[model samples]
Target: MKPLSRVLSRTLFYLLVIFVVVYSVFPFYWAVISSFKPSGALFAADPSFLPLPFTLEHYKSVFLQANFGRNLLNSLLVAGGATLLSLVLGVLAAYALGRLPFPPRNAVLYLVLAMTMFPQISVLGGLFMLLRQAGLFNTHLGLILSYLLFTLPFTVWVLVGYFRGLPRELEEAAYVDGATPLQTLLRIMLPLTGPGLVTTGLLSFIAAWNEYLFALTFTVGDAVKTVPPAIASFGGATPFEIPWGSIMAASVAVTVP
Candidate 1:
């Protein structure tokens, strides 16, 4: 009975995993397949799982007509810039909070955590005004700065946890060997926390990449708009008709990365 129960449990676990994988992956798969189908097939009575007649017209439309290449570049620039800045600042802040015995350290850390809990919408109006006054409105710099609100807190928090988990003796040894604080961090702590750095940076990048509210609110021109807004702008000749094929194609293109 024990052996039978064990076998059944393993089988159930595998089946659950398979179900989760399919549920997560099917939408992306369907988008890719639908993107390849011609516009007519997209509106047919019966939808096909696979593209019976594959065409590149939608892909071409996205690149040539919609100018998605520019949008893609904008998103990369914004996300990359935000990630870089967040990592640099977050590392310094986390190291200080985690390693130093300064007064109000816990207070500062808790304050950072609290900032993350606030809804972004709560600050959008003030941020918009501030961006305009600072001459950052409608610019990549503006978007990058706005993204820092969330990314910086996240990076700092994650790195602080990682830094605290690191052995103190390594840092003490570096100090005894005549290493400066910066050198100690660069030579010892950073390398040890490489996984934490990668995890935080990747999360920051994805957050900035998918951000739509600030992208839509801050920018007016297509030249600086990210992929989220660019994809949202995909439309048909009239309000009544939506271009699902082109939208799906652009979605698949953006999602591939």
Candidate 2:
């Protein structure tokens, strides 16, 4: 009886976990399925889990009419640029905070963290004005810099912890070997923190890729507008519905990978 009870509890726990997984993933699963379905099938009274009549029409339509491909390219450029810049800058800043005993290190870190938490809306007007004056408005650099506002703080925070956890003896040994601080960081420290760096960079890319507010506010043309704002252009009032199938297709195109 004891063994049976234990088995039953384990089975229940597995079932609970499975339920949560399904709940979280069901919407994405539905969107994917709907994207592949014909418009008639998508609007059917009873939808099937499987794509009974799969078609690439929605994907083709979005690419052809909505210019989603161009928007996708813009997003990739902005997000990739922002992630690279943030990772390099964040790593250096984290290394300084973790390894060096600079004056007011704690105070500076606190101030940075405080700035990170401030409402973005509060600073948007000032940023817009600055970018316009700098002739960076509607440019890729502007998008990348604005996105840094979102990605950099967390990147610094995360890398600070990861760097602190690293053994300082490695740096000491490198110094004894006559390695410069920059060389030690580039050769030794960075190689050891691959996973953390990858995770942080990927999260930063995703955040910048999906950013809507700054993109919409800053860009005027499709040449620089990212995917999220481009998608929003489809939304209309007065029962003017979006093409759900095409939107889903565009979403999958952007998100997959």
Residue 5 CA displacement from its true place in model 2, Å: 2.3
Q: How close is candidate 1 to the true structure, as a TM-score?
A: 0.96
Clashes of 2: 0
Off by over 4 Å in 1: none
Pairs with backbone N, CA or C atoms under 3 Å apart (clashes), candidate 2? none
Give the C-alpha miss distance for residue 73 in model 1, angstroms: 0.6
Task: Kindly report which residue stretches of model 2 are placed more than 4 angstroms away from their true locations once superposed.
Answer: 235-239
What local distance difference test score does each model get? 0.95, 0.88
- For model 1, the local distance difference test gives 0.95
TM-score attained by model 2: 0.93
Worst 10 residues of 1 by lDDT: 248-257
Among these predictions, the greatest lDDT belongs to 1
- Deviation in Å, model 1, residue 8 alpha carbon: 3.0
For candidate 2, the per-residue lDDT at 131 reads 95
